[model samples]
Each structure stands twice: as C-alpha cells, then as structure tokens.
Target: MEKLAGMLKRSREDWAYCARDIMGVKLDSEQEKILLSVQHEKMTSVTSGTARGKDFVTAVSSLCFLYTTPRFKNGDLISNTKVALTAPTDRQVKDIMMPEIARIHRRMVSKGFGFMAGELQSYGIKTGHEEWFLTGFKADEHNHEAWSGFHAVNTMFAVTEASGVAETIYDAIEGNLQGNSRILLVFNFNRTTGYAAKSQSSSRWKKFRLNSMNAPNVLEKKTVIPGQVDYEWVNDKVSTWCTLIQESDFNEGEGDFRWEGSCYRPNDLFRIKVLGLGPKESADTLIPRYWIELANQRWQEFVKEGFPRHDVLRLGVDVAGMGRDSSCFCPRYADFVDTLKMVHSGGKANHTEIAGITKVTLNTHADKYTGKKAMAFVDTIGEGAAIVPILAEQGMTNVYSCKFSEAATDSGGNPLTDLTGQYEFANLRAYLFWAVRDWLDPSKGSKAMLPPDDDLLQEATEARWKFQSNGKIIIEPKDDIKKRLGRSPDRFDALANTFYPSSQEAVAQDLSGVFF
Candidate 1:
C-alpha cells in the first residue's frame, strides 16, 4: 500500500511539472476553463499534492480548452493540445489514450456526436443507453448537457475487465438496456487497447442487438417503450448466442455471415450477388489478373516476390453423398442412399460428370505449354474421395484432397485424429492452414497475399464455422452451408491449400518439373 501511494504521489508531481510547461504557452480565459475541467476530471479520482503533481494536473486542465473553451477551433485545438498537455504522467492513463489520446477520444466523441445528430435529424435517440452515450470519450471539458449525456460506460468496463467483472458487467448492461426501444448501446471492449472497439460483444451490439430494434431514422421521433421490453421482441437470439460463442473461440472468417471488423453481412432480405467472368476471368473461373496483382503489389514488395507462380496449381471440385439435389437435378439421379442410423443420405457422382470435370481441369490448368503456374484443388470428401486420389495418380500430383471433418476416418474409412492433423492422405492441407493462419493478418493487408476467387471469397465470407472451446475449427454438416454457402466449401479448401500450402517442408517431387 505504501509503495502504491508513493507511485500515485509521483504521478501527481509529474502532472504539476507538466502544468508549469503548459502555463508557459499563451492561452485565454475560456481555454482556461476547459483545461480546468479536464484537470478536475483527472484530479477528481487522484490525490493532488506536490509541485509536480499540481503542475501536471494544471497543464492537462488547460489543454482541455482546445475542445470546449472555444477560441481555438477543432483543428487548432487538435494540433496544439498534444504539446500543451505533454505531462509525463499522462502516459499512465492507459494504452489507448497514449497515442493521439486526445485526438482519438475527440474523434470518437465527434463521430458519436455526428452519428447522434444524424440520428436526431433523421430519427432520434430512443433513450436508455442509446441516449447517444459515449463510452470512452472524455467529457471533462464541457458540462453542456449535450455532451455530458454521453456517459463513460466503457471506463467502468475498463475497471471491470481488470477484475474479471466483464461477464458480470456485460450481463448487467444487457439486462439494463436490452428491451429499450430506440436506444443505442455503445459497448466498449477494446477501449484501453488503443484500437477502435472490435470484439465479439461490440459486434453483437452493433449488428444483432441494436440493428434488431425497429427504431426510426435519426430525423424522426425516437421510438419509445413504456415498459421493459419482452424477450420475445428480439429475433435471432440464438444467432447472438452463437456470435458470443464465435468471439470466445476466435473465429476468423469475417464479413458476410458475421464480421469482427468492417465486413458486410448477408441479409436474406437482400438478393444474392452474382459475379460473371470477364477478360480477367476464364470460363474455368481462373482469375489470372487477380493472381498477378496479388503476386506483384502485395507479395513481391514484401516476401520472396518471384517464388515462381508457374508451379502453383489450383484444383476445384465438390463433396457430397452420392446423390442429386431435387431442386437442381432428378432425385432418381442419386446413385445410392446412406446406411447411417441418423437420417443420412448417400451421395455419389455419376462417373461421366466426374470424368468431365477432371478432363477439363487437366486441359485448362495442367497443360505443360501453358507456362502459367497453379494447380487444381478438388474436394476430397464423400463422392470426391473416390476420384481425387485417381486424379493424383494420373500425374496430377497437385491434386489436393479435402477432408472437412476433424472426426473423419482413414482410407479404410475409420475415424482417426482431428482433420487439421490428418497428414496421412495429403500434406497439402497442413501447408494451406499455416499459410492463411501464420502468414497473414487479415486486417493489416498482407503482401504475400492471393485474393480469393468469387467462390473462395464467398466461402471465406460465409465461414461462420469456428474453433470449439478446445480450439478446433468445427464445421458441422448442417450449419456448413448456412455459414459456408449452399455447399461445404470443398473447393475453397483445395484452393487454399494449393495457394498457401500448410508447409513447405517436403515439396511434391512433381513440382520440380514446373521449375524449368
């Protein structure tokens, strides 16, 4: 306790020292009030003692004028506020506030203000947390009811997460504001991290919870609920629960099915988008220009640029029980049915169709004179299992076999280890996993990157399938299409593997010929 007290004292002294520096700069009375308000907030919870502490507090207090005390416009305030408030103890506030602390905080608040103003102009605030509350933005500079109404819900969050109070506080916030109509809740999970708020809970609040309400536009009267909201008023509660589950497990596919960052989500209310192949795309769906773009601007600038793309081949195929969908084909086209006790249906492809796809892959992608590098990725599950190995044997060594299930069995068709660890059939799967997971951070824009084709992009967007608590990317058959598209993303798996092999340890011997 004594040691902690001493540190606090030092912090105060440091503030005072900064205050002295701030006083040296020129400033007027309105600016002084804003600065004081800021200082008061900083000092309210802290002990103000020692010259250093006093000076530090005084300096920050003066800087607050840049926002509220008016003579300085927003631009002038932002430009000089950092210099005015350069107190050593300021860094101790937290990581998020360390960089452009004032700027980001101001931006967050300003953005919040703009958003709320837009809401008011179009619709209006519904009340409750949606009263246009600001979580991490500081309001010490101005006592104006307009800005003050924006509470620091996330400051409490900062205090709570440290004490493992997140679960409890999160529950309280949900309980307190869940049913209120026209109310917006700004839940801040990453406030202290300096990164803009991005988390499962934040995503849920923005996408599922807030969006679910039938609030009017910002120009209209805010929606009002006389009493607590009935639980039934919500749609897709199960989906929200699933989103929370996704966040806890670090599911990566964002935008479309769900998103962690700035990706669009699918609304059954909207029609699906169809992309056609143009000069950049072949009837085979080969995106050569996209590949060249990825290799040039993104990769060559960063990683070993000239890694010889001529050798990389992509194989495309499908996986299913030996059957045909009634919607797409005759049910009688189903060659066989399932023996599984749990309502299983068998799927087998007509040999003629499989031969055709295989022949096309060979002609379009694998000819020696094509001089382009790439492979054909084929789905290796169910009906696909029957033909992938045969393709591999037919000198298509780049034939990537897909095994979607971690509980999948061996060649003898018996369950073995998890799917990610299954190396017995093809080493390519392992290589692909590392390439996506280890090589790239989806947010930072990777250089050694290959943009996914429309099909791959669709799968990547819909891949709501994620790791279980045990850290495995679990993809259930039923939910696979719901999250990954109309079918299991077998083509995506093969392409991902070929482009970003799981490992470069043992190169396929056949690949040596492509180097020439």
Candidate 2:
C-alpha cells in the first residue's frame, strides 16, 4: 500500500516514471523525452521515423494521465478528466491506438493497476464516473462539430499520425482547450505543409524528432530499441528504397531519377519513411483528388434528381473478425453505389452472421433486386474461406466466394489483357481495383456514382499501381497499404469487390455453389 501510494503520487506529475516503473515498459532516450514532455508541455509533438514507437509513447502517456489523474471520493471523480484519443479515422484508432491501449492495460493488470482502470470498454477505458474516462473516437475530418463537445476540468487530446488530417479537426481541438488541458501529437512527420508539419514547426508545440541514424539499435547494430528499424532493416531499406536515389548522405531529391522503368519516387519514399523527413508532396498516388471531387459532384447532381433505374443489386463483403479490422458491406444497384455498412466483429465472423446479414440486406432491397440479380461477392481468403461451404449449404446461390489471391481471369477464366491486348492484372485483387479505378474515373463522362464518403475517397486515392517485369499491372498489396494507413483498407476493399466480373456472369447465367 505504501509503494502504491508513492507510485500514484509520482505518476500524477511524471508520466515517464509512471510508464517505466509502473508499466514495466522499456523506453529508449527519445521515447522517455516524449513521455516527460507530455506532462509539462501543453502540446508535445513527435515527428518520428518508422518503427520508432510513435503509437507506443502516446498510448502509454495517455494511459498514465488517464488512470492517475482522477481523485475519487465514494467512487466519483474529483476532477472530471476526459482523455479523447483520436487518429485520422475510427479504423485507425481501433487498429493502432486501441490495441496499444489494450496491451498496456494487460501489462498494468499483470503488475496490479486494474483497480484504477475499472473496465476496458469497446471504445476505451471506463471508470466509476462515466464522464471521467479515456475513449477513442472516429473523426470525419470534414465534420469537426462531431469531434467536439467535451469540456472538463482536465482534458487531454492525443492525435496519432496527423499527416493528412483535416484542419477542421484541429479547429475542434481549439474549441475545447480550457482549464488544465493538453494536446499530444505523435506522427511520422510525413508531409511538409499539412497540419502535422505545422505541429512540428510551430512554436506552440515542444517537438521531438527521431530517425534511423539516432535509433539506439541502428547505432549499436543490435536490438537497442525493441522495433524493426534496426541495423539490418536500415540496410534493407537502403538496398530497396535508396537504390535509385543514391547520395553521400540520405537527403531529398537524390532519388528523383527513374529506377528501372517505373515512375515511382524511390528517394521521397526513403525520405519520409527512413529519414523521418517530409517530402514536397505524396507525388506517386495513382488517383487524382480532382477526379474524386468530380465523382462526388456527380453523386450530388444525381441525388438532386431521383436515381436512374438499374436492376441488379450487388453487394461486396470484406470479412474481418476481431483483430482491429471491421467487416464492411457495400451495396450497389448496377452503377449507383449505396453507403457502406460495417460491423465490429468482436470474435470470429462465422457463416451464420455474414449470411444472416446478407439475407437481411437482400430482403431490405427486395423491391428492385431479387433471385439472380441480388449478388453478394464475399472475399473468400483466410477467414472468408471457412464460410464458403456453409454459404453453399445455405443455398444462397446469389452469393459468390472470391479469392483475391487467385490469378486474374475473365468470366470464362481466361487471363486478363490490357487495352492493346498485352498482359495485365497480376492478381484478382489488382483486377478488381483496376475495375474500381475505371468506374470511379470521372474523365470517362461519369458513368458510375458512389456515396461521397471521405474515408472511401481517401482509401480509393491512397492506392498506387506498379508494373511487374512480366508487364502485369498490380495494385499495392493490402499488407503494404495497412502499414502506411494504420489498418486494412476495409471500406475500399469492400467497394472494389463489388466490381468482380461475376456480376455480368450472374446476369448471363447463375453459376451457383462454386468458389471463384
């Protein structure tokens, strides 16, 4: 009891001490500085390189303040302290921060701090007082109003990976900076001109910069820090990303030249990735912002007038059970797509849940699409494959199981070709994304339309295309995309699956009960 009291009192003022001693987490010099800075500074900004524990420091410090701040009298908090930890999106929060929070909580419980954090809820940590707790939020960068409305005696806001975050989110935070409040900013320092860059440059924040050269592990050429950006990893990145843009020192513009025949920026990739510096721009994105805006404008114009008549009702299911990502459902009528619906699968997504939801959605849209026209294209890779036989047994002939890892083929299972009849489409995933690209290309006179969702738009544009030596065009892998963005592009993957050519096949002839 004496030791507990001492730790709690020190924890109120010194978060680094709280983390190292209380949580048993080993922090390098830079990480310790971030935790200490968060206490005295109103805004502590960290522009960290890859694998530098950007998420870890923020999560630990926030947990430190959240559990130790509240003074309880008969189970009611003396100061209604509220910690709102937000990422660019809800999925990012769930995937990056929440898991870190859970891990820290596990460590705390093991070391005996379960008494402070009463219960771990789906959103975040809960205490005796509902108003006095820490929670993770999903912010629509455009809708700053929804992100507001928490004014407490003690308020803390932590934003992870602020690169492309909407300025409106910062505006919302400005509104709530009252009483004993602080802002914790941790990100990759990815850009030169965004709000994230401003956080690094502005005098309002106490900044800490970390990169490959300074990492203890890289210097010692061993496991100095606990992450992957060690000596061997840095050399690997040099071999892969630093090849085309060679220079005496790792700096900007060295990699502006072409590597092989691809137009990808190898140097800028190294700059933002390894050196922890921002590029002039994210220059290699496949889709343009203007084209997406055109699509959004097109959707609005169509909404002003009633939607045109289209018969087939198509649905795409990106299956994810537990483990950070959510299962998303995207429904469309021929060319016009509807808003996406996603469910948080706290456990494994069994056949019953997905099938029942599919049946329910089909029944709801029964006015226009029925029988052969109502098609549910389910992603049948990994967790999805288990549901295939069960879906077959359910006799939902309209549902087709699609394996994204399979080779790209036409409705007749022949290899795909480009405009000039050359080889194209490295895999089924790439083929679907390319089809989505075509559907969303506003320059093609706006043939198809989808809901104007910011997350959807961000996911669609973030994907870049690369060409293989064999002349096959491929979209960036899902794992790689997940690394850049905090979670799987679940929403966009759901959108892309709806473009499977099996829709035309279903219209032609219903080939039921077989996995594609």
- Candidate with maximal lDDT: 2
Tell me the RMSD of model 2 versus the true structure: 18.1
What lDDT score belongs to each candidate, Candidate 1 first?
0.30, 0.73
For candidate 1, give the lDDT of residue 386: 66
Would you estimate the TM-scores of all the predictions?
0.29, 0.50
Clashes of 1: 54
Q: Which ten residues in a row have the lowest lDDT in candidate 1?
A: 329-338
lDDT tens digits, residues 388-478, model 2? Answer: 5666676656667777887887766788664345648999888888777666554344456778776676577668888888878888778
Let me know the TM-score candidate 2 reaches against the reference structure: 0.50
Give the RMSD in angstroms, all C-alphas superposed, for model 1: 22.7
Q: What is the C-alpha RMSD of each candidate to the true structure, in Å?
A: 22.7, 18.1
Which regions of candidate 1 are displaced past 4 Å?
1-311, 319-348, 363-374, 392-400, 406-445, 448-456, 465-487, 497-516
- Best-matching candidate per TM-score: 2
